[model samples]
Target: MTVDSRIIYGSWNLEEPTTPTRSRLFCLEPIGLGTAYVESLTGYVARLSETHYVETGMLILTQIGPLMKEGYTFDGRAGGIDKLYGRYTRAFNGASNWTSALISALEHLTLRHDLKFLSVLPWVEVIPLRYLLRPSRAWCPVCYQEWKDAGKQIYEPLLWFFDAIKICSNHHYPLCTKCPYCQKENRPLDWYSRPGYCSKCKEWLGTNQNSIQTDLGEPLKSDLNWQLWASENIGSLLATAPSLVCSPSKATISMAIAAYVEGTSEGNVSSFANKVGIEDQQIHRHIKGKTFPSLKTLLQLCKHLEVTLLKFLTEEPTVEDLARASARLPQLKNSTKRESFVIRHNQSSIELALKEALLENPPPSVTELSKRLGYASSGPLYYHASSLSYALAEKHLDYERVRRFEKMRSILESTLQKEECPPPSMQDVARQEGFSVQLLTTTFPELSRAISDRHKEYRQMLKTVRIEKLRQEVKEVAFQLNKQGIEPTRTNVSNCLSKPKSIVMQAAIEALQEVRHQLGWEG
Candidate 1:
């Protein structure tokens, strides 16, 4: 039976409404204390559906509304019904922003008093979709076991869904993606999917906590420590999302990156990409608002780039604000990794190096400058003098780009004027120049035009040479046929020659006509 399209209200309502109508069907408290923060949308919906003995499918129709009515669906892949929150916000509360819509959804659906604790919704607007959430759910077996042991309702924390977090900060264990019993992966929005239990086979997901210790190497341990730090910081940032006066903007992130990699080899986007193992093109896209990073990728970049997550997310965090947060990170006493921590106490040597580097004839790059001054990475230059370092790097990168363009133009122009051999085509020139054709055209338009003109003449000269070569081959074949007492007709000569008829061209036709006139065989 088809349902009517009008928005349904009063299908169910509370009798003698309590000030904060906490659901009685299931007294599930938010995972972190008595706060209103629920860990994930999957957990929240699963608990709500369980109270009514319904599955995810029924919850969508009854709770999330119909496809045509509100354009809501049970399966939105990784984003999962987050879109529904927006629709519900517009429909009932008439709220415009995602943060308000989220608060409205919690109040309307479950009436949970802990609406203020839910951090994900508040942060939904600020974080780019790439770093916001993951498609498949991740669970820490230790966390599940702890929740079960405490007699608490089993649920997934919103923290696990962030792509940035791989290891559990509490246990230092990696997250699990599959059910222990059935060994199958489950999507968070599956029709019958339940939190803390396998969607298939209905097995508990907490039993597969392996006792094996994760010890990859020194580098991996350092990475694990960094991951643990990031988990806590990012998690705390989300937890406080509801109370933030103004959300962190993309400009804030750009500010942090520009501040840290100054006066170093890793100052420019290309070098930064190499240092961080991300594509330079992607870095360009992210800065330009063309795309965004995933949460995991963003955190990894933060760790390597030496910018604290707190500062990056904070709107106009002071130098002291960054120092306080950075000081908490574990320092490597002996390791050679470049530290980007803010150095406010004494910066005389740093200042001297910057001055010398800036004054050099061919300005010493951040990386080269760092090497000469006995530094491992370029992070410190930005840490101490962020604005100046960034300005210098930007100026140097632009200067270097122009210098390279001029050098390439000179090389190409000189190559074209060479009298020893014919000028190479653009493709050949690009191969010798070690640049892409697109780069050649886009970065060096004037040179591209010069190459085009030279290329046209070069092609014509090659064509003439090929025709003369074909003409010589045909004449030799015709002479050979005549010496053997075989009539050198056009068809006979064509057969006599090994070259294809197409390549024989007008030269072959002229040769055949002359041979015919000499032999008086013009029929």
Candidate 2:
């Protein structure tokens, strides 16, 4: 070639040069991308902070928070930071608005579009948010230890955040909620949280022992079997997220349930419900696309119907496949007996029971009334006395509404009466009372508003107090630096404070100027 041509060209093309765009943050690849142990978004944040040698809260407040449409704020106080990492942080790994926002912000920072797979956001349409994620952190010590020992990165998996996953599939060990050292339950992510360490005590959470011993009593074989099934299936569902062509929809699950009912129970929804031991109303709601079944309920349905949850959600089964699956389940002898009992009871008896139920001081629910009437379900009572049943149901609903309102009102009033500095937020109160924020606000508008107003005022007061405290500390630090002939500069003064990051630099600069004027060293 050298002899044949004046210049010999290599295989590489030098004329067309390509330059790769840089990411604002490190493009750290998530662990277990398509596996059951995929890294959680919360864990990814913690890891990213560690890589940058900054605290998790600082990373969020400085780099990521500003990018989010709903900006995150911290008052440079411990209490305010605690609220940032409280129960809402659990939603980071779930299919919630918070998760979606975080995913968008992180993808923008890292230029990695696969961040959505770190959460259950892909299945948001089919998975209900209620009871979707664990309230706090849960992990397997053995898994952590093993990963550390193998020189692999320690991370919290998205599977561990699932409220339904109790056991680790690989080790068959129960996941630990409380830290072994401190015995305290940690939020999913805290300001100083790090993977494989207790957020409270900063102790290593992983165990070095080959066989980890737990305080939890041995789980029953049947319970373990069910737990394992749920864990493995949910894990498989997560693993399939990246490969899914389209996100599964509520209609897909509804159609699957409808097909199964049609094939197994001759299109009688009640019969299918009875066979699966789920409420007929729940089945109807699910089939009508009104509400999706919770993850636990969906798993229970899949278990009884002999269908994998992944398949039940992703693909609709044929009639023959449903029939075969139904054939595998044992005959429901109790269901048949209950159905016959309901049929034999006279409609007159049901009407009489409904009339009596309406007269009770505290009305019994229709289901309870049905049980008292020796009926398996409320369907028969409604069928026999439609108008009376409707009236009774409506009355019971009214009673429930009043009772719940009073209970929430009482609790909220008590909360307001407390002398705690920095009153609890309405969200926290709602969570403690086991109600939704909307329900709390709508049911007791005045009380909810008062509580919210009190919290806002207290928070504002705390912010003012903290800023003053920070300013004083900065002045003292600057004075000390000046006495030492160190030139009371911003950097020097900051280095002298106990928590320099907590002070607003602008405030610090003003304080430093005041100190300099007092010392007759004005620039």
Candidate 3:
């Protein structure tokens, strides 16, 4: 069969469909200026389908080659092709790792070249880990809103395809995996799926206020941040997929693991695997260069070690980096659930330390001691060294009682010496100081009686001074009004004094009225 070069080029869709002097054929240069990343596989398919006036993704996919309508799952897995919807770059055909079927699809269907489809999908050529691609779909509501507002073409970013990416660093909020209206999960490839909207309900995929909630407690927050950290780092790596010259090797990962575990239990494969939430044999194989870890496992291992994937894969960890990774040993150990050995070590260390401290002349209280020793709870001290711990607690209680009595005595002396008014009642003073009234009375009965007697005297003194003050204010207001050639009427006095007529002090108003009558200004 003698094939013409033009026909060969046409079959691969590498040549322009129609070479006109002015206008070029429909070569879908990514809907947006997607340089390094065009759009997700689902998004790219949808755009092409829309352009071809097709209703389903399967129709567009089948147009390219022998793709089964049911087999186009879009879950980044191998189906009829080696990587039908996966992140693999090379299309292996039992012999070579070159001809990518996805690139071929873009070429044939869109009449575009493979290089034109670089950012369109997470090709294994770009991302070596297909396991990082999520089975379901995720979207940032804020990113969608920003795109819509900016009138940019709506497309799913390749970053959202990663299962590790949950939080949107740009929005500082988590991505929505489920639809708010339909309450159904979004899938990568569906029959009538559209980007930036729910397939079932056709609702906009923009996140709402309700989606940014965290059901996990504070203890799990570190884990959440760790996941976010992974998402951010991986997203950054994917952003530079076009310029990525080197893919990470097994030896690079082995070196990072060795550096991370140099001075810790992680040096042991069993311990490292346990901490990384992977099987020991699997970790050992990766370490020995017998196998490579899946993208998810590698991410977990990096997250556990507090090291970035890019740095670990690219360069050897520095001494400072190693020191920092080692420092995380204590924090990481504290953050996780402890084994029997860790618990025993902590208990014994805490007991011995507390016993040594108890021998000091001025012993510390249990709460203060707990803080100083970095113990989250003092229960261990009480459980392990009950006699010494309890004795310390009892001694502190006695000291606290004496201190309270002394504070009460000072308060009583200050109150009695106050001559502006009489002393307040014991209950009022106790309330002011945030002390229990019963506790104060029981501790200082004599002082309590003195406060009560002084409170009565203070009330009488306040009554006399209040009346005198009111009379003086009324006289002053009247005198000023008369000087201004205004009658010292009740309304005038109230207004001049800046007092509301309704809330004018009754005593002051009455006094003004009496003075007005005496001054013949009662009209």
For each of the candidates, give the backbone clash count. 12, 0, 9
Index of the highest-TM-score prediction: 2
Model 2 lDDT tens row, 267-316: 45667788888997788777655778999999998898888889899875
Model 2 lDDT vs. the true structure? 0.77
- TM-score for each of the candidates: 0.47, 0.64, 0.46
Model 1 has an lDDT value of 0.59
Candidate 3: Cα lDDT at 403 = 78
Error of 1 at 400 (Å): 34
The digit string of per-residue lDDT tens for model 3 on 368-455 reads 6655665433334454455666567556655765777798888877876777443566656876888655456557788777776677
Which residues of candidate 1, in runs, are more than 4 Å off? 1-29, 33-38, 66-106, 112-119, 208-223, 261-291, 317-523
- After superposition, the stretches of candidate 2 with alpha carbons farther than 4 Å from their true spots are 1-19, 69-80, 83-86, 209-211, 214-218, 333-523
Q: Cα RMSDs of all predictions? A: 22.6, 12.4, 31.8
Q: Per-residue lDDT for 1-523 in model 1, tens only? A: 7777795745766577667655533545556532222466556656667767877646654554432222233332344444444323211211123333334444556556555444354454346654355566788887787778788787767777766677888777778888777788766555566778777777777743465455545765677877777787677665665567765555445445544333323235455566666776676556434566766667777666465565566744356655543453333232243333333333677777777677766776664555566544445565665565555565566678789888777877786577535556565677777865545656777877677667667667777887787777777777788788888877788876776553346777887677666666675
TM-score of 3: 0.46
List the global CA lDDT of all models. 0.59, 0.77, 0.58
Worst 10 residues of 1 by lDDT: 87-96
> What are the clashing pairs of model 2?
none
Clashes of 3: 9
